[model samples]
Target: MHHAESLYEINDDLTPELMGRVDEVIQRYANRAGALIPVLTECQKIVGYVPVELQEYVAKGLNIPGSTVYGVVTFYSFFSMVPKGRYIIKVCMGTACYVKGIGEVLNRICSEFNMDVGETTEDRRFSLEAVRCLGACGLAPVVVINEDTHGDVSADKIMNILDQYT
Candidate 1:
């Protein structure tokens, strides 16, 4: 876990460390518009998810509207307002997967981790999400452990899969 003080490294009043790093990134790009994406990406890395304070900081640094920055941040599916966990556990709840008893699998995972869909563990070790489709209907009732896929899974299989991760 990061100490509470460490968070100030990114969100505090433009420390020399932060200014030096963010400014260097902004200046590297010939156009401010070109720097937008990289600036947000770098900021996310520094502060976990993009906090409102960081959004204002980024706007001032890039000389863009804060609303504009917020819009871009929220527009992208990849961007998250909340910090993510170490492992992303996506249960396929699409029609095919659901039909094949995906709900039972989801319940087992939620029960074991003591978390609901879209929630990360307090330790930030694992996160659960439900997706529309993983494009593996043949592998119905699928669960993706990060990038690797496990097909035709049962509730009991989830425990074993989680063990591999821990």
Candidate 2:
């Protein structure tokens, strides 16, 4: 966070302070055996999401190939390149939920929020994602906002449920 000439060009979200933290993460794991995943994980934690710029920075710092970094990032479902919303709304797309009218619920959210799956709203208030299942078939048509689960979610009631989040 100290005021200093930044070596790398600053990114939109990757502020000089965050870049400094990323530098610390790289230096901590540099030259260590099997450090790529851990380094990327920590850096992603610091920066919220890992873009190509941070991947290249970590690769250069660790003396590894950028493709190797990109591969690991893309392979891992947990690593995200884009910034996530404050609330992550995961709609269940499993057979039970689908049959129970989860599609209507999903569509309502998309139409209301003007965003599709895997995309965040312009205000970054919420991110919509379609997941295979949430393991609550009894509560079909489920939508999970962050850690809290809402079962038996109807398209009509989805907006009200989302109001709690907003």
Candidate 3:
């Protein structure tokens, strides 16, 4: 989608009350250079991601320069530039997990969904990510779907775990 359209599309998920809150925030710190962070925090809360166009809108709304907003957003990893999927799949690639046949598990996921790490599916139903560890070394070969953790997972177990999200 076009970047301009993407900014307005954020309103689709944001309630009128939330948008009003965003407006209030902008008005409150319209003149402060440091207001960029709070404004972004509110925007991210209302819309899960902070796309480039939204950054521009926030800058314009607060009479701040676009570069100022862009700089702050890019500086933080918590602020996502791209849209996130409803289900976030985190595969543990830590040393312990990797040694325990985690490679096969990762391969299975890549083949099944045709997706690589940091990529989301076409339907936007799932986003695949690989993390260093989930602190479940005991449960090596761990695959986390959102908050739920699946440990000692095998290629066969992947389907059962994914079915929960669908």
Candidate 4:
């Protein structure tokens, strides 16, 4: 068991240094009211995403219920329980984009990256999302990488466009 544990460390992201920072955040807000959000935000900034382990840690630190921490994390759109990629790829699934063959573009990305929608690549290079619409009907078959909007994207052209980012 010791050998196995040594080989595979759990919560590898939560190192002593990061946890110390987290402790500081908890201390700064432990005496204040409505401190959960700010604490979570600060900790997330320190440790990328707020995993369940950190949630329970914060809950214990604040003397709050674990469910309360979980609830707040789930309720807020800004708080993400999972890690995000460096580049976020939003593919429009609106009627206009669909008619313009956006599916092919989306499929191309999934096949090339070996990831479905709402999943991040293994290298953490990109996160794929299929939004209902991007409000750009004229720019059908749109793929937005981070904040850059790419319109009229095709399967053949997607790999080249994505290559520009890295």
Candidate 5:
């Protein structure tokens, strides 16, 4: 299917440089079977998120349908369609964490940041997410900001912890 205007026209952020990078990635894996995933991965690394425009661009480059690209992007939990914040704060909501009052911690972080779960702050400084588990039951009520994991976090300590990121 042909679009009225190119994806670049619709999205101001889809610059020529980004399109060039996408083209390079597609060219590198054009003849390879199952190249969509790797192409999308490389594009996402450069652009942070796989926007609809990027997906369409990838589809066109790979000579595939846009729906196929969309399917792959949506099917993968790690793929994000929207831009992520500078800091991604993941609150563990596992049974152990819940029992230890993770709810309060989550609430405190959201209330302080003025953002709900899976939402990014207006400043794009932080994105809050309540995950099923962080695989650290021993450190019940854990909060991971980027690569730094803070175990045994208390609701009151959320601010101090976030301060380190800024």
Candidate 6:
């Protein structure tokens, strides 16, 4: 069991209503074997991200160790402890994209936004991520911002593309 002081401070967005939803999800899956993943998924859907405080809460609710929850979260790329921004910017880092100058595109974005891959902007506007591929090899050097994809992107054109989001 973790002491209160050792747990993460819950954010304001984690309202009673949200916690109630999480609790209901937990109750539904707590007794089932291999329930952790689904429970976490449902919680993430409600909370946007699964912070440590929520993890501990889920652990206790499911009668599982917090370390196990932490392990699963850390092992999964889809899981994130920090809240994601409104827009998620995914830059393809595949061989084709890299060969087509995605590195420069990524660098330009990082320099302009003052953020690295897997980091959200200070204003919580954009979150940048480097992905292995987007499966658009024909459209190499793809940058997907939110649901829109820009193929054959150039480094100099990144800022122009980002302007459309705001």
What are the C-alpha RMSDs, in order, of all predicted structures?
4.6, 3.0, 3.8, 4.0, 2.5, 3.1
- Candidate 3 lDDT over residue span 33-141, tens digit each: 6788888987887676777666777878887778988888888987888777789999999999999988888888889989999988888788999999889999999
CA shift of 98, model 3, Å: 0.6
Q: Looking at candidate 4, what is the lDDT of residue 21?
A: 85
Candidate 3 has a TM-score of 0.81
Q: What lDDT score is found at residue 50 in candidate 3? A: 77
**Model 6 regions more than 4 Å off:** 1-9
Error of 6 at 149 (Å): 2.3
Q: For residues 1-166, what per-residue lDDT tens digits would candidate 4 score against the true structure?
A: 1121221255777777788888889999997999999999998899878888888888988989999999999999788888878899999999999999999999999999999998998888899999988999898989999999999899999999999988
For residue 156, model 1's alpha carbon misses the true position, in angstroms, by 1.1
For lDDT, candidate 3 versus 6, the one ahead is: 6
Clashes of each: 0, 0, 0, 0, 0, 0
Note the residue pairs that clash in candidate 2: none
Instruction: Give the range of the ten consecutive residues with the poorest summed lDDT in model 4.
Output: 1-10
Error of 6 at 60 (Å): 1.4
Supply candidate 3's per-residue lDDT for 64.
73
Alpha carbon lDDT of residue 4, candidate 4? 17
Per-residue lDDT tens digits for candidate 1, residues 16-134, read 56645655665665365577778888766655567666677667667788999899899987777787787899999899998999999999999888999999988888899999899
Q: Which ten residues in a row have the lowest lDDT in candidate 1?
A: 1-10
In model 4, what is the error at residue 83, expressed in angstroms? 2.2
> Whole-model lDDT for model 3 versus the true structure?
0.81
lDDT of 1: 0.79
Q: Provide the lowest-lDDT 10-residue window in model 2.
A: 1-10
lDDT of 2: 0.88
What is the TM-score of candidate 4? 0.85
lDDT scores in order: 0.79, 0.88, 0.81, 0.87, 0.87, 0.88
